[model samples]
Target: MQNPFSEEQVRQLNEIGKLPPTEQQAKLQAMFSTFNEEQIKFLQNQQKAVQEQGGQCPFCMIVEGKIPSQKIYEDDQVIAVLDINPATRGHTLVMPKKHYALTAQMPDGELAHLFMVVNNLAKHLFETMKAEGTNIFLANGAAAGQRAPHVFVHVIPRYNGDGVNFEWEGKKAEDEELAKIREQILKEGFEIKEEVEEEPEEIIEHEFEMSERIP
Candidate 1:
């Protein structure tokens, strides 16, 4: 697209961008009022292009209902859905409605709520699907085999000879190395203390009864 903003308008927008979030919207509205019809349309298209680029994550699209999902549970902060390409039967995914690439980026309260949803889904599998055991798995980053950009917890129901393998060859670390690793983790934990104010936990009742087999 051609440059839609003149030098003066560009300067004004830069000033607007630096404003506090609460003030920027009113400033932007006032700025937009001065634009001609064609300039306004061009700005609108540019804004839309930016949104499309930023919101293209598949999980975000699913949350927006732009993409269909076999959703079993949904609330203000989280959603649980059956994994279409499941590891085994009743392999469901629980994720935050907001897009977060890593758990580290999420607020402590939201993270707590997200895992609470995961726990309930696990319980639902055990009760409704008669799952003997379940694995609450999360691959946090690309290095950890995370295929999607959005973070999600996988609730995979376990059975005897289910053929899902999360095994790895066990290696014993030296005592000194293990001690050093533990120390590092403890130090990091101390640095990242929870800061979000704890909200009263709300009881959420969800019905997740479904056929054990997907159609």
Candidate 2:
């Protein structure tokens, strides 16, 4: 199959990939804004092709017993295992038996079950490990620091002087902006109604060029 991206674009994409996962999506979105609709579609196809290339997900391997792990809990729908590289002792990762890139891709029942397992595991850690506190974290996407393509929830047991920091710089929002956000979310059906807008004329102008072949 022919490569869809130009050499320069490929280089830019590589650089974007090098950024922290939390920052990568924003940078990629900025870069994507420069591409035409056809280019965007080509990028989407490229993404689908990459996923179809059958790259093994490590979490899936763990579920299949191909990769050894410290299995703490398991059920028909999900499994819980200790993280090899833990932020704290007794840190566990709870994931669905089926592979999913994001929680949003999972069914509501399955997603709920996954978290219920997490809650129980957190309590277990607190009682068994005598943890002072706990942090239940889910990195939903690359933009949220998700390293693996498979989705999982982290349950990290916390203790005094653990030195683990999850803090971020605080930004103050104006009251008007906060009210607008609250109103948007609190609207009927709990859905935010965004105004539909058309793409820029230039972004719609470029045609899809699969290859630079001259007939």
Candidate 3:
């Protein structure tokens, strides 16, 4: 795509860019001072628009019907929707109806129930779509590639040559190292009121399975 700015605007921008680092901020302030009230308001509105897009929670809007989505499953606690950007044909995303900013923030009851819904959807996708395999993944934080503020459980159907890859270092640690890690998790003393049933490990390997704040 071509540059959006007009000739004069482009020239002014280039001139501003060429200014010394120490002078750039003052130059920018003076340049904006030339803009009239309407221009100033327009710039402010543009800034706010960017902030809203970056900071606004999208899944919350979808649950509220403010954003249109084709929901495949929904109940009192959680909802599953077709992923707008799919890794494969039958890719889906399951998330809580109640927005939890982080997966760790979700109550144990909600977390257990959410995966049950996820499990059912994955089965339907694998059977109906005849996927060779499947991957259940959660990108927990920004470092893990989480784009939205909302927690999303990605149910991706995998074929033999799907070209999707999650390259891990597969780094190994000592048994003593692993035992110490286990000890810290046990130290936290967090236990659910009732234990939740776990799914078979034969199917998709549920990613993001880890304890908080590695010891």
Candidate 4:
């Protein structure tokens, strides 16, 4: 499938992949310096897919022992585990117990709780692993680099000068054009409402039954 995230955007991000640490930080700030409404919505939708799956949550399967993972932390509402393919040392994934493909799919309470877990894990990695800092990331869709259709947050430890990088090049836009984009987003935003009611309750019940059967 064609990536929903633009090649231009990726290229801009990849530029950081080539830069020195100080320069990379500057680029990162500049990249997000002008986020428009559409971009925000796109990212929001990207993260919200988790709840749409009716909390027949994939992360729950891993926690329940139906799926295998290098365990990090496990609790009733969340789980933290090592990424099978990590980008940095002590790389961990934080996900909610309920299945959510994207952040937008998550109920506000669940999203808040998920981030709390992520923050706690990041603190542990920084203190226990003795890292300088961390990168907390969420990929909401395939276009945004999400391989699985589950909502997850990546906590990657950053040292003083580690070469691990994710950078890209971006095209500049005129103020007029940016304004038009913002207007369109606001127009659409009015039409967008939380569709939690659409989620199938049966799926939740089935998932709960499966969870009980697991040893």
| lDDT agreement with native, every candidate | 0.76, 0.74, 0.69, 0.66
Question: Candidate 2: minimum summed lDDT over ten consecutive residues — where?
Answer: 201-210
Candidate 1 residue pairs that clash? none
Best by lDDT: 1
- Candidate 2 residue lDDT tens string, 50-109: 655876668888988989998887777778889999999999998987776656445566
Better of 1 and 3 by TM-score: 1
User: After aligning candidate 2 to the native by TM-score, how far in Å is the CA of 22 from where it should be?
Assistant: 9.3
Ranking by TM-score: 1, 2, 3, 4
**Candidate 3 worst ten-residue window by lDDT:** 203-212
TM-score of 1: 0.67
Any idea what lDDT model 1 has?
A: 0.76
Give lDDT: candidate 4, residue 50. Answer: 38
Candidate with more favorable, higher lDDT: 2 or 4: 2
Residues 1-215, model 3: lDDT tens digits: 23445588668867977976335434445566355545445444543465467654578778777889888777667778889989998899999866554565455677887787777777777777899988999876555666675678999988998999976788799999999999998896767555455432332223222223323
Most accurate candidate by TM-score: 1
Residue-level lDDT of model 1, residues 35-103, one tens digit each, is: 765666566566446558774768888888888998888877888889999998899999987766557
Where does candidate 1 stray beyond 4 Å? 1-51, 183-189, 197-215
Which stretches of model 2 miss by more than 4 angstroms? 1-54, 183-215
Residue 146 miss distance in model 1 (angstroms) = 0.9
Q: Tell me which of candidates 2 and 4 scores higher on TM-score.
A: 2
Candidates ranked by lDDT: 1, 2, 3, 4
